[model samples]
Target: MTNLKLHIDYPHDIPIDAFQWTPETTLEPFHTHTSLEIGCCISGSGVFYFEQKCYTVRPGDIFIVNQTELHIAQSDEVDPSTFIFINFDPSILLLEDEKLLLPYSYQSEKFQNHIPAETSLACQLQPRIMTIHEELSQQDVGYLSRARSILIDISVLLLRNYIGSISSEQWRRMNHSYRELRQMLEFVHRHFGSNIQLADVAQTVGWSQARTSRLFREYTGKSLRDYLAQLRLSEVKKRLVTTDDLIANICFDCGFQSMASFYRAFHANTGTSPKEYREMNGLSEDFEKLGDANEKSK
Candidate 1:
């Protein structure tokens, strides 16, 4: 019998979401508020598409995606693909005094530029990912705290592994690129819901618009514009699930220019219209509240 795995936990306040998917299903293209992602394959095999490169993954395999990289997952064979995804805000690793103790320090250098398929780091990370998955599966309080600790441990392991591999000069070069990328990412996160232009983003990162476009595409496998659009749509979905804002208001709030554009993009990305998507997802109450709020404000 083929065993496929798909599990999701919608925890409140953390802005992180976890889910599992198997060969029988495919997940839509999605981005997250969390800048770092760690996933492990427990059984079967699959492929992960990131910034146009396809990484073949299997049991006992793991991959780390830097923040805001456009990615999708798919199963490779009839065997069910079982894996666990751990997502978290990058700020969790940026505590003032502890900032230097992170993998992010190795930025554009060999460590950041190359993604080793099966490293000693992978061996260290597997247990941490597994432990977190177990804790999340539990129906206990403080699960969020437990998850956070595991994530921090994983980050430390990555930093240590990276430091062992390169010279200070290499580290310095990579760190420079890493810093620029981090800044670029911060700008996107902060202003995704505004009238952001590609040239503006380039200027913010101190790179020419063409160079910035190439680097972003190289790192994330999607154009800057498309990535921002995905981020906006993701924010809109989160609001739809958690707030009572009108669809039109949510659309504008998410930086969409008009209801028509929002509808087209939403449907193209999510396979459903905003109104119908909300209704189908048992958000009828939210739909009604949005209508009521609009009428009241008039």
Candidate 2:
């Protein structure tokens, strides 16, 4: 399967993005991104694949994916599967309550991605997710605020379910990891454009470099150095879609000190040069409608 790290650019001033997703005729490559995604299967039956596990999904089932897992969903040939996906930055609600992110911070190997339709949580989540899509599409007064409130409520239910499923010892360990993960993510977001190193990140959590790297890789699926590069490349793609900045300038700003290295990484990961990616995804014509950039992925 292909390894594609999807770039999700949240529209300006809007933290949550919700949309209906119907699997296409062609297969979608296994992929992951920094954005936390929750998908509700609305119709038909199909298979959802993670790194090594596959779950059969039916109507009203819920799937949660964090930055750790590489995953995709495919509909059966005879009956198409359709879903509504809610995506947002992990930071969107971090400032409110770090525990709200606990559900998404699950260890991929042990986490349960699919919540069966028969469960109360699954039934509750499906309607709330649809409400999010409606709020986003309508954009009524205080829509975003209402949407975030709904998100928090949804997160709370997820948290309660997760809390009920794990032991107290596991909760204690995950709680510590959650705070550290948020710290690392925030620090990287602030200084990813600079010459930061593993030691610097370790300093944030006051842990040895080795231990820090181990935990980070365990949860994020990449080493700290590689994860930093991943963030840089994501920033590069976002700028390419939304701005008119020169390619070299964008590369350097995102912390790729060497233009050649940036170009090589870009080509290797995306199968397209920066120029081609931009040309295909650029919203230069209608800059204000920046939401168009996300259409490329659909």
CA-lDDT, candidates in order: 0.66, 0.83
Model 1 over residues 99-188: C-alpha lDDT tens digits? 333454333223342244367767777877877777777736677677777777777677766676667776777667756766776788
Give the per-residue lDDT digits (tens) of candidate 2, residues 1-298: 7789876756534446988888764668899886788999989878899888899979999999897689989898888899999988666656557788778877788899989999988989988999998999898867888888898999999998988767788778877877887787688779999999999999998889898888776545457787777778888998998789999999999999898999999997788999999999786566645557667657
Model 1's C-alpha root-mean-square deviation from the true structure amounts to 10.3
Clashes of 2: 0
Candidate 1, lDDT over the whole model: 0.66
For each of the candidates, the C-alpha root-mean-square deviation to the true structure, in angstroms, is: 10.3, 9.3
| Model 1 bad stretches (over 4 Å) | 1-124, 131-153, 280-298
Which numbered prediction scores highest in TM-score against the true structure? 2
Cα error, candidate 2, residue 134 (Å): 0.6
